[model samples]
Target: MSSSPRRPAVVRRAPGKLFVAGEYAVVDSGNPAILVAVDRYVTVTVSGSHTPGVVISSDLATHPVRRRWHEGRLTADGAQGGGRPRGGPVHVLSAVETVAGLLAERGLPVPELELSVVSTLHEDGRKFGLGSSGAVTVASVAAVAAYCGLELSRADVYRLALLATARIDPKGSGGDLAASTWGGWLLYSAPDRGFVLDLARERGIEAALRAPWPGFAVRPLPSPAGLSLQVGWTGNPASTASLVSDLHRRTWRGTASHRRFVATTTDVVHAVTGALESGDGPGLLHQIRRARLELARLDDEVGLGVFTDELRALCDAAEGAGGAAKPSGAGGGDCGIALLDAAAPQDISYVRQRWAAAGVLPLPVRVALEGIQQ
Candidate 1:
């Protein structure tokens, strides 16, 4: 028999991402959306030892476990007080333990690992529509795979992350996870079958490949310096799940207004994609303005102001400042993205400062080409 002990586990890293389109539309109908991995990322390091322990530490949570426990509910009286224990990180740990167990169940060797996480995105509760949680979950799953020496596909990892996060927040489309896992522009729909892949090839990699990557196109634009953006916060945060539920509920009532709004969104998204491919800045801005108008129509039809008054005012200000604004995620209130043409960095900075004085936060970002990997 071979005598060498298993080598110590190494650090694994996975990139995070943001979705460019189809945020809310991907909920019911199978309409494709695009996403790109951002430079912001989360890295997980796994260390193995003969001793039995599992530890995870990151900004969101930290848990150390000596051994596995039954996944059943713990009685309040059983915790030294001996009934059921107060809930804490146990659920998260339980999820992690389940992953480890799945590997063992599959007849794969398992390691007692210490996992450390380092993240460069959203340390606080401010999600900013940048897909932070999806990135972290994807990173964690990657760590587990590395610990188990497994080569599971990105799709499997994305599915697992979705299941795990759903258990906690009970919301979200898996588009962010797919973007962070697979990288590049993702064409995703609601159901499984409607999804399509769009990836950017590494310089040499694309050149050597016999054919172009499927469903992907290259768009030429001036560098990000000339493309200024002003991200506006609405102060009132929204939940994707709740917004989706509301949309569904409204649609089910045979609400003519809701139907019309969704139909309009479909057309706008189609137009957005066309403008994106054609590199028509003015056309893209127009579509964004149209999308905002449709959203306003829906808000009026629903008789509720989904975007806060302050947010609307800020968007109007951006439009006055030579850009068009639209909601970044499911409305209610979260953030808005503004697109500007051939703007100097100072102009964008001044715009952000103005928002900051009013208590809205702006984040700077550019398109990215790659997704999660080793």
Candidate 2:
């Protein structure tokens, strides 16, 4: 008899994202922030392998990694003279390890597989700070889980990706991960990092992955009617980690100024979310301006210049066209977004030209309708 048909290869796609508001503040204490998953995506494909090892490859990597499952672990042939495999792309390795750990917890054998990743989130080999890492991690985990004949819900995939990311950097707010997992427009609050880390350490990866995450919440918001968005890239990548570290060192956590910043940002987020739900174009613009001003105040108080000259010029150009603009993420550089009022729509072409003249390249990105596509 013919052998049973081999399972087809599985491919998963997750989108990059940008913060609409609440950048630095979100990491503080689960503050709510708005984010949008963009059209650009990172795709991961996985298939069973006849060879006795797993192969992981990515366009971002210099070489593919070949690993074998032995003695309850994955190890490369020459990795540390037969010790556990270490040192591939951290994000990729973390994703694989997370999948392996979960499967092991369920008494499932690690399968031999081939995995590959491709992404359109970078420009000229420089990251656009579009949350590529989070997209890749989500896609990788989804693809691997499918290859193992397991299906994961959107929420479960998100928690698994977040857990894997936490293994690498526990300080992440998970805003990007949420955008990649759920897609579209979202209001997200990060879970308590300390709690998550402790649970993972004490109860293990499986328990943490299955547990109800505390202090984490994600709500989908409808795109406001009569509102248009435009993104401009500064062509310089900003290190989110560095910006967060600087802000942490400069601003005392939970102090009066910090509390004021959080409260103001929370109010701005509430206003924006309400405007979105109500489809109030003018109200959205008003809240966007207020939010940007709050960020400016936070920058001054912390003595960290999150808004650079290019970003300021981009925002100024947008405002000159009667639109509201501000830096999208932790903005030493990277991108800024402009929200144009529909009733008084500015010429987007003219806005783009002005942004170009100000040394910012306008990006063709929109809110992705779907989150993770499998």
Candidate closest to the true structure, highest lDDT = 2
lDDT for each residue of candidate 1 in 1-374, tens digit (9 for 90 to 100): 01225566666565655444455555543555545566667777776655444545565655543432233222222223434443544433434543554454456555555666677655364555566667777777767776677676665665556555555543355666777777655555443312211111122212212233233232222222334555666566666667766766664435676566657777776777777666677777887788788767767766545577656766776777777776766766666777776545665665677667766777665554566677
Model 2: lDDT of residue 184: 88
Name the weakest run of 10 consecutive residues (lDDT summed) in model 1: 193-202
Model 2 — TM-score against the truth? 0.92
lDDT string for model 2 (95-148, tens) is 877887778778776667788888999876788889998999999989988878
Model 2 residue 91 lDDT?
76
Off by more than 4 A, model 2: 1-6, 50-53, 67-86, 343-346
Models 1 onward score TM values of 0.74, 0.92
